[model samples]
Target: MKAFLILEDGTVFTGTSIGSAREAVSEIVFNTSMTGYLEVLTDPSYAGQAVVMTYPLIGNYGICYDDMESARPWPDGFIVRELSRLPSNFRCEDTIQNFLEKNDIPGISGIDTRALTKILREKGTMNGMITTREYEDLEEPISRIKAYSVKGVVKATSCKEKYVLEPEDSKLQEPVRRVALLDLGAKKNIARSLVERGCEVTVYPCDTPAEEILASCPDGIMLSNGPGDPKENTEIIREIRKLYESDTPIFAICLGHQLMALATGADTFKLKYGHRGGNHPVKDLETGRVYISSQNHGYAVDPESLDPSVAVPAFVNVNDKTNEGLKYTGKNIFTVQYHPEACPGPLDSGYLFDRFMKMMGGNE
Candidate 1:
């Protein structure tokens, strides 16, 4: 069936409908990754956004059950230049088309994705809709797009209740650290990553307070990534400030990183166009090393807004020279803006997770 994407600017790109017949409207963004479409779809971080894949060809490897970052797909809609109808990977058990249909998300293919990406780059990310409209006029869609806002996204995707998971049997030894993972729409891999390293992880919701979390007597705390503006999460930041005094060796990624900055008296601002891909390069200031990273964020910490006495730059993006990480002074706190648990990365960032373990005396 014929389908199209309508941007808030009244731009329309024609394409073919490939997923469910439902209509979707949300913030439109683009990703530059050439693979891992599965991971991108299942990542809770993409909630309330329609993703345009920059890579010309997608879904070539089909889908794997083990590759899901979350239990279900999160993107409101998907756009692609070409979707592989017959995936050839041996581990593949399902096709992207089927996955999209089952998850109630729409996918539109055969569009000029390169042109769309260019428009997003120039205008910054904006609202869009994927629909099989009855008419060609875009007035209604444009108006809806202009008024739409991605609010309450984290609450929608976060776990309703706390859950626990022991270390995986494949670990070298029994679990040592008990980690409190605050799931603000967190990806499953965040907990899996901790479990793999022999940490007993307890997942918590976004509304949970500092006193309640501290009662767990956790050896460490992980601020998991989520969707939306960091400054809007004022309460979480306030609780984080209280937790900071404990020097609990907190490790945060993506949204967590931003909240940590806000907790430490730093500020955050939205990017003109957010970074979303696997090939981004980052330089670690402390180690003086550069490594490829997997990233998905639209907000960043303002380097000038941070208090030098409270926190120091730990990592920075090589492309835009933006602050990518921070290390707190006189505290056991460190954070990164990229996903260290994302697979098919440089695999060098996982050491950050090890550093968290070491802080909790799990380095043995």
Candidate 2:
């Protein structure tokens, strides 16, 4: 089936429908990852947005049950240059199109993805409309695009209830290490990573009270990445502040990093276009080493806005000089403005997960 992608600026690109035959409107953004399409599709960070893959030829590895970041795919729609019809992998159970079809998500393929990526890069991200067939007057779609908002995206994509994905039945006799995870639209993989390391994870909603969390007798706390403005999520800061009363170790990523800074009396602000790719370069201050990381956020923690006495800058973006990570001098809290889980690309920061595990007194 034929499809058309219309940008907010009246730019249109024709393509072929590859997934479910449906029309939708969303903020269009591009990612530079060459693999891990399953993780990208399931990541809640892409909620309320239509993702355009810069790398051509997606779905080569096929879809498996293990790589999902969330319970379901969150992108309003997906766009790519090509979708492989026949997938080749031992662990593959289904094709990309089948997965999207099962989830009622729409997608467009056979378009000029390189051009689309370039446009987003030069013009910043913009709202876009994807239709299975062309329409006569583009006014309605354009109007819808203008009115689109991702403010409550985290709530929409978040897990309505909690569940667990443990590694195996190996360490049943050991003391159950506890980690309180604040699910600000958290990804399943992060929780799985902690569980795999033998920690009994208790996932909580974004607004869960600090008193209740601490009452659970947690050895550590984790802040999750999510969508929307960090400043607007003031309630999370209040929760973090209450957590700071104890000596429990705390770790945060992406939006969680932003909230951690805000909780420490720092501030956060929006970026011009934000970083949404998988090849962002971040430099660690203590180690003096640069690591390629996966990032997906539109707001960053302002180092200058931080209370100088409370938190110190721990990392910086090598390309844009933006603040990337922070560490509390008086407490055991630390955060990074990027994805260290490496869902789609460079695993340089995967060690950070192990660091968190070690902090919680679990064997790495």
Candidate 3:
């Protein structure tokens, strides 16, 4: 069936429908990863957005259920240049077409994704609609697209109940450390990363209070990545302030990184076009080392807004010189705006997880 992608700017791209026939309107963003489409689809961080894959060909390797970062796909819609009909992989269990149909996600394929990405790059990210319905007048859809905003997405994507993940190695009699993970729409791999390192991870919902988490007597705390503006989570930020006062080691990622900054009196702002891909390069200030990292966030901590006495910039993005990580002064806390537990990206920054383990005294 014929589908139309109506942008907020009134530009419409015609394509063939690939998923559900239902219409979807969302903040449109693009990702540059050539592979890992499955991981992108399931990542909780994409909760309120429709993703445009810049890579021309997608799903050639098919979908492997083990690669999923969350329980279900989170994107409001999907856009791609071409959709692979026949996937050839030894571990393939399902095709992208079937996955989208089962998940009820609307998508458009065979469109000029390069041109769409160029427009987004020049004009910044904007809202758009994907529908199989033909419209003679684009005024209504464009207005609706412009009016859309991503809100309450953190609450919507977060886990409803707390759970625990034990160490992956059964041979280990007791876990090396106990970790309290505050899940702000966390990807499953975050817990798995700690578990693999022999930590008993207790995953808490985003709304869990600081006192309750402190009562658990965890050796360390982990604030996870999520969706939406960090400033909107004032209550949670207050709790994080309490956590900051504690001596227990703390490590945060993405949205958590932004919230940690806000809790400490630092400010955050939306990016013109947020980083969302597998190959973003970040440089560690302390070591002067560059590492290709996986990232997905729309907001960033304002380095200038940080107080020198509270924290210092630890890493920076090579592309835009934006803040990528921070180290709290006189505190056992460190945070990064990129994904260390990369599901579909380079593992160069995976050592940060080990650094967290060290902070928890697991290495000792």
Candidate 4:
């Protein structure tokens, strides 16, 4: 089927539908990652956006079940320059096109993805619509795109119910560490990381109350990554403020990082186009070591808004010098804007999980 990606700014690019034929309206952004399209699609952080892959060729390696970050795809749509006719990989379960069809997600291929990426970089990301209709019939969608806003995206993507994940390797006789994870649309690997370290993980919904969480008597708390503006979640911020006030060790990632900052009276602002790839270079301020990381968030904590006496920068992005991580003074709390679970990319910052383990252990 034929399709056209129409931006709110009156830009239109014609292309062919490669997957589901359904139309999609979303905040269109571009990703520069050369591989791991499957991970990109399933990441909850992309819940309200449509992705344009700048790598030119996608689905070359096929999709693998192990590469999925969440239960299903999150991106409203996909744009790629080329779709591999035959995906070749040892662990390939199915082709990307088939996966998209199964998940009811739309995709467009055979377009100039590089040009689209350049447009986003120069003009900043904007709302867009992917439709099978001709350009002449795009008036309604254009109006729709202009009025579209991502609201309640985090609540929509978050888990509906809480669950527990025990250690993968139960043979170890070590003392089981109890960790309560506040799910703001968390990835599976975050829980896996805790389970692998012998921590019994209890994942709560985004709206889980602070009193209920503390009543569980957890050794530590983990705030997870999700979609949309952190400030819009006023209730979550209030709960986090209460959580931080107590002695329970807290570790936050992505959206969790932003919410925690807001809880501490700091501020956060959205990026121009946002960071959404696996090759972001981040430097640990404390160790002065650079590490390649996977990032997928549109907001960053404002360093100037933070109380210097209460919190300090732990890491920063080398490309833009934006704050990447924060360390709270006189508290067992820390947060990072990047993914440390590695997922489908570099594992340089995997030590952050170990640091969480130490925090939980020391508090015990």
Candidate 5:
């Protein structure tokens, strides 16, 4: 069916509709990953956004159950230049079209994705709507989408209750390490990586209490990535502050990293365009090593607000020199503003997960 995407700027692109023929609106952003469309679609962090893939050709490998970051697709819509119908991977179970159709997510293809990505890079992320049936005048819908308030995006995408993703019995060599994973819009890959390392991960909602988290007797804590301003998430910051005195090693990523900074008396601010891609470069201060990272967040910890008594800057974004990682001076707390559990991105930073394992007293 004929479909089109309408940006808030009044720019429109026509393409072929592949997923459910329903109207959808979301903040429009682009990703530069060359693969992992399935994981991107299921990631909860993309909840209120329409993702545009810059790689052009997408869905060539089809979709598999193993790569899902959530139980269901969460992105409001998807856009690509081309989507392959035939997938050749041995693990392929369903085509991208089938998955999106089944999940009621709309997608449009055959558009100029390269041009769209360039525009996003130049003008920053914007609101957009994808429609199966076109209306003569798109001014109203575009305006509505542009002005739409998508507050509490973390709540909208977070897990309603606690759940576990366990590892196989044969994979366990010792008592299952317990981890309270605060799901401020967590991606499943993070939990999966922890499970693979023998940790029994219990995902909790964004507003889950510090008392409840302690009651779970977690050996470590994981704060996940999500959307929106970090200063607005004052409640979660309070909860994390309560956990700071404990010996539990706290590890955070992206938005979680920003919250960790706030919990420790640091501040956060918005980025002009923000980082959202697979190939961001970061420098590790201690090791003097660089790593390519996957990132998707619009807010960052203020470098000037670093608390010398509590923590110090650990890693920095090479592009904009933003605070990308933090290491507490005395506590067993550390965090990175980039994803180590790469989905469609590089794995150069994946070793950070092993570092987390080491902090938990697990031999890698």
Candidate 6:
């Protein structure tokens, strides 16, 4: 069926429908990864957005359930240049069309994705609608798109209950370092990464109190990546402040990184077009070495707002010189604005997870 993608700016792109026939309106953003469409679809960080895959061809390898980062797909909708009908991977279990249909994700294919990405890049990210319904007048859809905002997404995407994950069998006999992970819509790999490194990970909902987490006597605390503006989570920030006051080792990623900055009096601002790709390069200030990293966040911590006595910028994006990571002064805390788990991206920055383990005094 014919589908229309109506942008907030009154621009419309018509294409064949690939997913559900239902309508979807969301903040439209683009990702540059050539592969990992499955991971992108299931990532909790995409909760409130409709993703435009810049890669021309998608689902050639098909969907592998094992590669999913969350229990379900989180994007409001999907957009692509072309959809592969016949996947040829040995691990392929389902076609992208079937996955989207089963998950009720609306998508558009055969559109000029490059042009769409260019618009988002030049004009910054904007709201858009995907629908199979034909509209002679674009005024109403554009207005609705403009009024839409991504809110309450953290709670919507977060786990409903706390759960524990034991270390991998290889690390089972080793001394287990307990980690309290505050799941601000965490990707499953975050817990799996810690579990692989001999840590007993207790995953908690985003709204869990600091006192309750502290009472568990965990050796370390972890703040996870999520969706939306970091400043909107005032209660989570307050709890994070309490966590900061404690001497326990702490590590944060993406949204967590932004919240830690806010909790410590630093400010955050949305990017003109946020980083949402696998090949972003970041330079480690201490080592003067750069690593290609996986990233997916719309907001960044303001370096100028940080007090040197509290924390300092640790890593920076090579593309825009934006803050990529922070190192707290006089505290065993470090945070990065990129994903170290690298579900669908490069593994260069995976060492940061080991660094977190080290911070907790765990043996390598």
RMSD of each: 1.4, 2.0, 1.1, 1.6, 2.0, 0.8
Top candidate (TM-score)? 6
Task: Assess each prediction's global lDDT (C-alpha) against the native.
Answer: 0.89, 0.84, 0.93, 0.89, 0.86, 0.94
Q: What residue runs in model 2 are displaced by over 4 Å at the alpha carbon? A: 162-175, 361-364
Kindly list the per-residue Cα lDDT of model 2 for residues 1-364, writing each as its tens digit: 8989999998999999877788888888888777888988988888888999888999987999888887789998999999999999999999999999999888899999989888888888888988886778988788887887777776676667654444457853276678888898888767877777777888888777798888888888988999877777777778888887679999999888887787778888877667877889999999899999988887888878877678889999999999999888887778899988768768788888778877777766
Q: Candidate 6 residues 1-364, lDDT tens each?
A: 9999999998899999988999999999999998899999999999999999999999999999999999999999999999999999999999999999999999999999999999999999999999999998888887888999999999999999999998877787356899999999999999988998889999999999999999999999999999999999999999999999999999999999999999999999999989999999999999999999999998999899999999999999999999999999999999999999998899898888889888888875
After the best TM-score superposition of candidate 3, give how far the Cα of residue 293 lies from its true spot, in angstroms. 0.5
Clashing residue pairs for model 6: none
Give candidate 4's TM-score.
Answer: 0.97
By summed lDDT, which 10 consecutive residues of candidate 6 come out lowest? Answer: 167-176
List, residue by residue over 122-171, the lDDT tens digit for candidate 4. Answer: 88889998888786666777899999888888888888998888776752
Tens digit per residue, CA lDDT, model 3, 63-150: 9999999989999999999999999999999999999999999999999999999999999999999999989998888888888999
lDDT leaderboard ranking: 6, 3, 4, 1, 5, 2
**Reference-based TM-score of each model:** 0.97, 0.93, 0.98, 0.97, 0.93, 0.99
Model 1 worst lDDT window (10 residues): 167-176
Whichever of 3 and 4 has more lDDT, that candidate is 3
Poorly placed runs, candidate 4 (over 4 Å) = 137-139, 169-173, 362-364
Tell me how many residue pairs clash in candidate 5: 0
Best of the two (1, 6) by TM-score = 6
Q: Residue 173 deviation, candidate 2, in Å?
A: 8.6
